[model samples]
Target: MALLAAFVGTPVAAAADDPDLTSFYQQKLSWERCGQDLQSGARSDGAGQPPGFRKRLECARLEVPRDYGNPGRSTMQVQLIRLKATGPGKRLGSLVLNPGGPGASGVNYLIDSGNSFANLGRRYDIVSFDPRGTGHTEPVSCGSKLAPPPGSGADDSLAAKEKRINEACGRYSGGLLRWVGTQDVARDMDVLRAAVRDDKLNYLGFSYGTKLGAVYAHEFPRKVGRMVLDSVEDPTKNAWQTALSQVRGFQRALDDFAADCTRQADCPLGTDEGKAQDQLRHWYQQLSEQPMKVKGETVDETSYVYALREALYSRSDWPALRQALEQLRHGDGAGILRLSDAGGGSAAHSDSVPARRIGQDELPPQDQLALRAISCRDTSERYGADDYPRAERELTKASPLFGPDIAPTLLDCYNWPAAGDDASRDVAAPDAPPLLLVATTNDPATPYQGAFNMARELRNSSIVLTYRGEGHAAYTTGDPCVQRHVDDFLLSGTLPKSHTSCS
Candidate 1:
C-alpha cells in the first residue's frame, strides 16, 4: 500500500535549529523486543517490557526536556513501542498513534492491538509512545490518597478536593506540572518524529488524541504528512463549552440507548424512552440517598453515571449496560459495580461485554493524576465560584441523567494552581497535505458536530468522513466501510470525496 506517495521523502535535516533540541532530534533509539506479559510500569527503564524478549514488538525510550522553554533545566524519558513494517513492498515510514485519554498508554494500546494495524504495519512502522507524564514517562503522581473516593458525587466539597489535589500535584511534580499540556506533547511529537527519521509525520489520533494532532498540525503544518483525527474534538470550544457539549452528547447517546432498549422484549428501561430516562433519574436519586451494596462494595450515583458514560462510548458495550441495568433493578448491584470498575480501567466484565485486560488499560493513580493535570492546564475554561450553580442548572436542563454529574467534574480546573494555555485554536494548515477527519453521528465523547466544525476550520485541506452511527470512534469498530475509507486514506493518499458518509 503506497499510501500518500507525495509524502515520501528522504530524511530532512533536523526541523529545528534550537541548540536545546539538537541533541534530542539527533538521539538514536535502541530498540529491544518487548513481550506482552510485561506489566505497565511508571518508570522509563522498560520495566513495562516483558521478562523474555519477543520479536514482534520492540521498545525504546527517548529523552525529552521536561520544560521545552527551559530545556537546559531537566529532562524526562518517553517510553515508546514499535512494530516494524513487515513489508514485501517499500516501507512508508512510521505511523504514530495515540489512544485518546490524556492519560491512556499509547504504547500499551499498540501492543494489545498491534495486529489490528497489520495492514498498515506491513507498509509503515507502527509507532506509539507514552506521552509525557503518562505511562512510564516520568509519570505525574499526586498520590492516590488525594483522589476522591469512588462514587463521590459532584458538589461544593469537590472544590476543596480539587484544591488539595492541585496542591499535592504541585508539591510532587515540581516544575513538570505546567509542561504537561497538549501543546508541550505536540512539540514532543515533532521531536519524536525527527528522532524516528520520519521527514514528515504520519499520525492517527483518537478522542483527546484528535486535539493533540490538531495542535501538532497547527504548530507544525509543514511537517504533517498524512494525518487522521478520529472522533474529532472541536478545538474552538472553551473548557466549559467542551464539557457542556459532552454532557449533552452523552444524554443524546442515552436517549438513543433508551430508544433501542424499548425495541427489545427484556428492556429494563421500559418502552417509553422519556419514561425510561425518568426511571434512570429516579434510580440515580435513590442510589444517591443510599448506595447499593454489592460484594462488600457500594454503587452510588456517581459510579452508576460514570459507568453508563463508559459503556456508552461504544455500541458493543450497550448489551453489557442493559444487563447491568437489569441486574441493578433486581437488587444485584454487581453488574453496575463491574461496569463502573471497567470504566475506571479495571478488567471486570459481564457476559454481554468481554473485557480484555491490557497491562496499561487499568490506569494507575499517577496516570489519573496526569490526566487531570494535563486537562486543567491545556484548556482555557475554568469554573468560578458562581459558575457552578449556573452550569448545574444548564446541565440539568440539557440532560437529566448525566447533567448534574457531568457539571461538577468541570470544577476540577476551578482551584487548579497551574494556569491553562488556550488549546482551542483555529487550525490553518494550508502547507500540510490533505487529512481525513472521522466522526460518528452520535459520538458521546467528541460529538459529531465537532467533526463538521473541525472540517470547516480546516476547510478544503481536509475531508470529512462521516459514519452515520453511534460510537465514540469510527475506525476499528468492525465497520468495514469506515475501515475501508481509513485504510484507503492511510494506505494511499486517496482522500474520500467530500461529504462521504458511511453506515
Candidate 2:
C-alpha cells in the first residue's frame, strides 16, 4: 500500500446523522495557531521529481481519540502529507494512500516515489499519512536485537538468527500488534475522511493496502467513492489458506523465472530449464547441510531460501538473483550476502539494534497473542498443533526454496497463543461498492489467483483486472491498459466489464 497526491481543497467539516459516529466528513477546517500562523493549503517539494514527479506537498495534523470507542480519552496526532490539485474548481478532496507491510511508511513512500503518479495529480489532491504505529506515527519498536545483520549467504549459522528474529518479534511486539490489523486501520481511515472533510473517500491500494481498502469498504460502504485494489489478497482467508496460496504464487513466479532464464544467454543456472531447476533445488539442499560464508558472516539454508523467494517479489531484483545463482554455482557467497543485507538489517537507521532503532513514534509494539487472536478468530479455517508438521512437509514438497519460510510462518501461527473466537464472527458484507480488483499475472506476493478468488467472493466487485505483466501491483506502473482502467475507475466512476485482461 503506497500513496501519491496533489491538494484540491481547503479543509472543511460535514456532519453525519449518526451521533455515535467517531468520524465525520468535513472540509474547509480552520485551525488557529498558538501565536503563529501556517498556510491553510497543501504543500510539496515544488519540482519535477521525475518518474513519479515530486512537489513540496502541504501538511497538517489532526487530533484523534486514542480509542475510537471513547473520544474523550487520550488523543494522538495523525500527520498528513498532501499534493494539491493543479485544477481550479473545487476538486475532489483527496486520494490517500497506504503501502502494505502494515508497517511501510506511506508519507516516506510518497515523498520518495511521488513522481510516478505524474498523471494522477492533475485532478485530485494526493495525500498520504503515517498510519498508526508506522513510520513517524507512534512507531513500534522491538529494541536492539531485532535488527537484521548486515549481508546474507548460505551458512549453517543463520538458523539461530532466524529463530532469534521470530522470538524477538514475539517478545518485543507488545499489545500494539493486535491493534494494527486492517479493521483498526479502516477505522483510522474513517477518522481521516472526517478530519479532511470529504463526504466520500477515493483510494488506490497496493498489496496489503488492498486489504485495508476492502475492510474500509465493508465497514463504511457509503464513504467509498472510487477505489482501486491492486495485487489483492483476500482478508477472509485463514492464515493457512493465505500461506498455501502464497506458496503457489511463488511457484508460479519461479516457473516464469526458470522459463525466462533458460532463454537468456547468461542464464546462470544454464540453458536446460530442468537442469536449472534441479541445480536450484540441490543448492538449497547443500546449503541446509553446509552453509556458505561471506566476510566471516554465516547464513543458513532458511535465510538463503527466504531471500530467494523474497527476491522474486520484484522484477528489479531478478538481475541480483541471477548473480547470486552464479555465485552459488561457483561456491562463492558474496552476492547472496549482499541480497541478505539489502533485505535484513542488524540495526535501524539509528545504528542501534533493530528492536530499539525504530523510534516509539513509528510503530506501537505488537501483541503477538492478540495478533493471533484476531487473525485466527477472523479465519474460518483452523489448524491443530499436530497439523503443522505434516503441512510443513507437504509445503516443502511444493517448492524447496520457499517451503521452509512459508511452513515456519504457518507453524508460528498454529502455535499462536491468541484465542480464535473473536474473529470467528463474519465481517465481510458482500453488498459493499463495486470493487475494482487488479492483479499482475506474476505477482510474487499476493498472486493473480488470489485476486480472482477475492473478486469471486465480493458480488459487488468488478471482474478481475488482469495485468499480463510482472511485479506485485501494476496500478502505479502497469501497462497502459491497466493504467487506463484504473484511471477511468478512479476519475469517472466507470467499472470494467465482467473481467478485463490488460496485456
Candidate 3:
C-alpha cells in the first residue's frame, strides 16, 4: 500500500562550504522535493488508498536504509504528506506533527484537521508522514489476536482467551514488532528530514508522539529546529512506570468527571459528588458479581464501565460518556459497546475511517518477533513475575475506572518476548535543542507527571505551556493558549517561561 503524503515542500540545498549539514540542515533550512512522486509544488496519491477517501492526496515512497547501522542491503520506505502554507511569504519552514498514539498517522492528521493549525498553516509548510509499519507505510498487524474482545464485554474464559490472542499475535506478527520501536521511527524522521532537504526539522507531537519527538531529539538533537511536545510522555521512564502513572491520571480524571456529573441533573449517579463516587464504586462491586443484562447482553463489570471511563479521558467525548452511563443505569450495554468500539476499535473494524487519520497501526504482522526482541533486549531486567499482581493492587487503589486495565496492559510488557529498554539512559542531552513541552494536569492517557519529567530531563528545554484542563491533548481541542504557544515557538522560536500555565 502506498502511503498518503501531504504538506508543502520548498527547494533547499546543503551548503557546500559546511563540513556537515549542521549549518544548512539546522539553520536556514529549506524544503526540497523529497525525491518522491509527491512533488514540491503539487500532491499525488501513492498507494493504499482508503475507500471513500480514495481521492485524498497520495504519497511517494522514499526508500531508506532499513537499519541505519547497516545501510547497504536493507531498505524501507518512509511515507510523507505535505500541505503547503496558505499564506505566501509568511511561510518560513515546514512544521511536522504527530497526533500521539505512536500509531497515529501524520498524513491523515493533516487531512482531517489541518486547519486547526491556525496562523501555523499560513506561516509554515505543514507535512506529516506515517512512521514505518504505520498507516500506509508497510503496516504491522498483530493479526486478529490483539483485537479487542468482541461486543461490549470481554470473553468469560480468561485463560483460554489470552492464550488464543497471544498465540495469534505471536504467530501473525512474526518479526515486525521488533523494528517498530521509537528508534526506528526516529530514523524515519531523519530520513524524512533529509528527503525534504530541511536544514532543521520543526516538530509538534502529542501523547506517544511526544515520546517519539523526545527520542528524535536524543538521536538527532542538533537537527531539531523547533519542537512542541504536548501531552508529553517521559522518555526516561520505563514503559511500566509510564503505564502506572496513567492509572493515577485516569483516576484523577474520573474524579473530575464524577464531580462534573453531579452538576447535571441527568447524572444518575447522584447530585452529591462524593455520593456519586460511592455509587460508582457500588456499581462496580455489584457488577463484578452479577453482570448487568443489557438488551439480553451480559455486560461484565470490567469491560463496560471501564470503557465508559476511558471515553471520559477526552473532553470531546464526555457527552458520550454521559449517555453511556445513562444507558447503563437503565440496563442497555449496546450503546456503550458501540461507542467504545468506535473509539477503541482495532484497524480492521474501523477500516472505513481513513487509515492515516483515525489511528496508526503499531506493527505489521511480519515484525512482531523483532518488536519483542528489541523491547525484551532493551528493558527486560526491570520486571519480575510479581510485577502484575503488584501493579494490579496498586492500580486498584489508584482509580476505580482504569485500575484494572492500566496495570494489566503494562504487565503485558513484563511477559512480553522482550521486557523493555534500558530506561536508565540519560534522556536529557545537553546538546539537544530547546524543546517546548506541554502537559495537562489531568491527562488520562499520557499523564502530567511524565511531561514534567520529560521537561526536567531536557534541561535546555522549557515548558511552553501546561493545560490545567483534563484531556489527552489540548491542541486538538483548540485550546487557545496551547495553540498560541505552539504557534509562537514554531514560527518565531520563542519559548514561554518555566512552568507556564494554559487556561
Best model number under lDDT: 1
**lDDT digits (tens) for residues 273-321 of candidate 2:** 8888898888778887998777887766765765576566666678888
Q: Stretches of candidate 2 above 4 Å error?
A: 1-48, 51-55, 87-90, 146-178, 343-387, 411-431
- lDDT of candidate 3 over 327-407, digit per residue (tens): 877767666665654442111111001111111223223223223333443454444345656766877777765676555
Taken over the whole model, the C-alpha lDDT of each candidate is 0.75, 0.60, 0.60
lDDT of predicted model 1: 0.75
Model 1: weakest 10-residue lDDT segment is: 346-355
| Model 3 per-residue lDDT at 127 | 76
Candidate 3 C-alpha error for residue 486, in Å? 1.2
Shift in Å, residue 352, candidate 1 = 27
lDDT of 1 by residue, 1-503 (tens): 13322233222333466445566766778998764444343223333434421357788888888887777788888988888888977898999998777777877677555566778888999999888888778788765455443464644254555555666777777667788888889888987887787878999888888888888887787788889999888877876787788888888899899999989998999898889988888889888898888888778887888788778878999999999999888877788888777652211111011122112112235556667778877866677667778888988899877788767656666667778867536576666677899999998878888987887776545988999998776786768998888988888888899889999
